[model samples]
Target chain A: MPNASEPPTTSPGIVRRFWWRSGQRTRLAVACAGVLGALAVTGAAGFSGDARLAERGGPGVAVHRGDSFEVTVRAVSGVDLFEGVEPGTGRVFGARVAGVSAAPCWQSQSLAVAENLLRGKKVRLIVKKDGDTGTDRLLVDVELPDGTDYARTVVDEGTASADVAARGELGPVESAARLQRRGLWAGGCTGYRDDALAPPSSTPQTSSTTAVPTTTTTTPPPVPTTTTEEPAPEPPPTATEEPGDDEWLARFEGKRCLLEGTRRTSPKGTEIVCTRGPRGQLRWQRAD
Target chain B: MRTEDHVDLFAEAVEADPAPTRVDGGRPRGLTAEGWVRTTGWLQVGDHPVSSVLLAAVAGLLWALVGAAALVTEFPVAAGVLTLTTPVVSGVLWWLFTTRLRPASTARNVDTCRADELEPGDTIRLHGSIGPIGQVVEVALDDDARVVLHGGARRTWARDDVVHLAELLR
Candidate 1:
């Protein structure tokens, strides 16, 4: 009874003091977090700023000595990464790729632009330092609108993945046989390293005879055109029209080189366009 | 998943893309455009991984325990050393946290080939209306039956001639 009478009105003070002690640890932790956070902010700002500065290529696009590369700097939908040459040349740069001038990546230095391009997008920049081959290497860097950038080392030949990336087999067997007779690419794609190619081709499947669509023969009837509308003043070319591989081959034969070099696509697949370069100078562009 | 370490590494196979570009239709390209490859392989550092990160954390924990034991009592002189080490350990832990938090599973465009589709291996022709978006590739083998190729289907098909489908279906 006597002990119960007074467990100390001060017991509340002990509890409060305990809480204060606990609170001190939490406050210390919060303070540490705040300091660390500020340090992190400063560190990140300094680091990212340095990276950006490095990216700008203040030294101004220093290439090797004489490296020539094929490139396609154009307007990609409303997001071009090039500016027209104010040095008084019509040659468009990456800033114009998206068809606008303010693509954040459009650095005036040729080297800096080379350092920033999308994977498949093309731009011709030469790495000419002093002694490297004039056409030393092809390089491109791309920065997506969302602050992500990608780079690709352009190869001398489109052979990094496959010696022959061209699609479609001999249009018809007889045509394939003719190609065999010509021994295209050491008898055509059959020459790609058997081991390098997945599921190695063992017997070299040769299709000297034509095989029609065995999957399903639902060839739609040819739709004839009436040419009802008036043609535009200067119609764009019809490079993308679908045709048989043999037909394409025929056209390709007439045009040994694609005239225009390669095809490119924006990340969103919003659009794709064709481009070409001769000895690394961007020469043509098509949207078909 | 370590069991898959030595397996065919399609785990890192990026979305499929066709090399020789073609136009499908008014907006059509060949089925090859929507082509893809299956693979399995090691992911790059800063990429996306679960087991590797966990293993790192575990290893760090062991080192931290050793560090703590060294700084207690007899080595109170090294307590400052331990304090300095804490943040270095903390930085690594933070990076691991960030890696887990911000992984590189970014969405990318890709396409693939299938068996018994319009571009069947035996056949070289694929006649179908690829859905407006390159997402729903409806290769119509028959009017009532349109085989749908989904996922990565972004390519320009310029030629719709009869061609081999087997090449892309690997």
Candidate 2:
């Protein structure tokens, strides 16, 4: 009979040997993970460092360009940004003009107003830290040097509408601007289109009106404090009445004009000049 | 019937019928059962799913990309906001991904095993605690209802510690 023997153990193949020997694959995986971790850390740090470097504009400048919004000025210690707010750290920060909602078409006009009023000027910022807007810009009530409300000016000029959430004075100002068909509201907001301008019935359904939030009552409460250092002058009276079929010149009043120097004679023989409005849109105004 | 004669007979039987050598102790050759299960879209590291980790990584990458772009454009406030909220956003996303993927049965598996039910040499993974796989050493269910487990170190854990008891197939 043959002698009994133990079966021969075959050696592991190259792949298995590589995988199991001293946990080589695990070490490789760990190393790869470590590299990825290092990259992520480096990327984050680089981004943060770049952001920090970009925050400041220049030393000793009173009004500086904001890193996020258009401008940044110090709050408190007489940075002259807002009134009746607690003093802050005086660090430069971005501030959003409260109570104005500038639609896309009117954004440039509102921005122009902001730049003119705020750039190289001392202003006040009443900061509200109630909730996160997902940006570093603070929600604030901005006031120009002459104590004119910045957001109110934008709304009153019809460059922007009152924010639906706005309380106090801005709502009434916006409603009055809309009623007068000022700036963007000219020719019922569809003045840019020929058909909408010819027919008065289609005026109410214009898409531009949708930007105004109708949730707030159209008639706002009377503002108690009307006394101000510089009250905005009332817009010059244009031909506001709905035009008859024969009245061609009457239709051009408060409507966007093509040329800056264009002049037309009204039925009353008064000269009307196409002049740029406060909201940056060119409209026919009575020649003073 | 003698012990020596029986040992010699067993040795002769083993030589007569030799079994084939299996490197993985006759278990499935390529991947372990757990590894095969992981391929079915339920990958996890301990209690957290691998998908959550990957999702958080992608989110972090996007956050970094946007932040870098914002910084290059000199929008420091936007970059600051993105940088500051990265960890929070990643954490929330990881939590959401893990919550969405975790199987209902696996979550309930923690309550299934107790110290009294465990026997010596039973291998288990604990929930809500970070440690290596534990091998039950002793089940001391006296006052504290703790089980002694030997993994790298011998330690006593509560009855509720065992999240899942796994049987290794060989």
- State which candidate has the highest DockQ: 2
In model 2, the clashing pairs are: A80-A123, A80-A124, A81-A123, A81-A124, A81-A125, A82-A124, A82-A125
CAPRI tier for the interface of model 1: incorrect
After aligning candidate 1 to the native by TM-score, how far in Å is the CA of A267 from where it should be? 44
Task: Give a tens-digit lDDT track for model 2, residues A127-153.
Answer: 544423222455667766777777776
Question: What are the models' TM-scores?
Answer: 0.18, 0.29
Each prediction's whole-model lDDT (CA): 0.29, 0.44
- The alpha-carbon lDDT assigned to residue B59 of candidate 2 equals 49
| Model 2 C-alpha lDDT per residue in residues B35-65, reported as the tens digit of each score | 1110111223544333434545554656566
Q: Write the per-residue lDDT of candidate 1 for residues B50-120, one digit (tens) a residue.
A: 23234334434444445544333224556457555655665575444433432211111123344223431
Which segments of model 2 are wrong by more than 4 Å?
A1-90, A131-135, A191-288, B1-170
DockQ (C-alpha based) per candidate is 0.00, 0.02
* DockQ score of the complex predicted as candidate 1: 0.00
Instruction: Please give the range of 10 consecutive residues that has the lowest summed lDDT in model 1 chain A.
Output: A1-10
Query: Candidate 2 - CAPRI tier?
Result: incorrect
